[model samples]
Target chain A: DAGITQSPRHKVTETGTPVTLRCHQTENHRYMYWYRQDPGHGLRLIHYSYGVKDTDKGEVSDGYSVSRSKTEDFLLTLESATSSQTSVYFCAIMGGAGLAGGNAYEQYFGPGTRLTVT
Target chain B: TQLLEQSPQFLSIQEGENLTVYCNSSSVFSSLQWYRQEPGEGPVLLVTVVTGGEVKKLKRLTFQFGDARKDSSLHITAAQPGDTGLYLCAGAPPGSARQLTFGSGTQLTVLP
Candidate 1:
């Protein structure tokens, strides 16, 4: 909620379709992350970007991809969405220097985007 | 994969009662963080505890990192209706300061 906004707050999509979620941050944080929250899973990281175009997979990277073309925008793409992917997606940005004495570990999360697949 | 497990998946307590939620793991972590999420909203950071056996408090909520750095606990005193929400614990594994492993979380409902 700290200067972070996610687009398409709620979406209902059918199976076998492609879906993309967008995360925009006004703060120029160097690190960005994508996570999914389900009923039994608190929050699982899908992917993360240390900088523009520098991305890496997270614990639950399968069936998902991410890209960061600009510093302020990070996008998560679900190729051929499945019912298992239906969950609340959240985007987070790592706080930069001067925040909490430059620890850079605290994450600020976006409002979240809920995707329902049938 | 390192896993953080939380206890009491669901809790319903009366106002003015005290409760404690736990987050345990077999893997050691460099630091641990606590967060609370409300309905239809993103999780908000509550506290971060570093160092073995470290303790931090925020008003009525007290958080303690385990001596082995593999577990943590959150204790709340005189709970109120406003405390109803999902509490999550996340740990930062050593050598990766940028990443975190989260627990399933404990859903708390404090009835007035």
Candidate 2:
């Protein structure tokens, strides 16, 4: 492992409960992202952080929020977990801004965290 | 929206067979990448195609980027059970952040 880990590899919770997932990396990468993988929809970005205290929304950020307090840790919080949020969540990191011609900008993903909302 | 579309959502073939997976989009990309994901795991990068019309091979796997940079294909020769997984294609548009727009993906099963 190049140094990316997600907490609570698996989880089960009731709907309407608040939940948080954590992503940690030791590579000191500048970019970190959170994505959800669902059947037929593949992986959809939920949020991403470029640096500590800097974050932005992704295509699917309606019910989700992210916080990056340090360069090595990014947290994704679901204020109210729902059945629809029951999907595998992945954390990824890249060394650079991923500009074109930056062949090494490929992201390295962590082992996914499976969440079940009942 | 710039979306990547992958075809043949599912494929099943016998060992030693040859097959191809495709990723297409109307929007041109600055670069494209292919990944393979197994159950309960995150996708692992297989290859990245940057130049239009470029081709790269990794062992028995062949990757091709369309001349227009709007599509790409992955061809596997002599498929094996080890190749069973979900194949995904992702693209990074020019001038945009390195956020990848991924295709739905292709689930491939190779029977031994």
Tell me the TM-score of chain B in each candidate.
0.99, 0.98
Candidate 2: tens digits of C-alpha lDDT, residues B1-112: 6999998999999999999999999999888989999987899988888989999999999999999999999999999999999999999888764788989999999999
Tens digits of per-residue lDDT for model 2, A1-118:
6599999899999999999999999988889999999999988999999999999999999999999999999999999999999999999997563343564368889998999999
Give the runs in model 1 whose Cα sits over 4 Å from its true position.
A97-104
Candidate achieving the largest lDDT: 1
Give the TM-scores of the predictions, in the order they appear. Answer: 0.96, 0.96
Name the DockQ score for candidate 2.
Answer: 0.63
Q: Candidate 2 falls in which docking quality class?
A: medium
**Backbone collision tally, model 1:** 1
**Which candidate leads the pack in DockQ?**
2
lDDT of 1 by residue, A3-118 (tens): 99999999999999999999999989999999999998899999999999999999899999999999999999999999999999999998853233324288889999999999
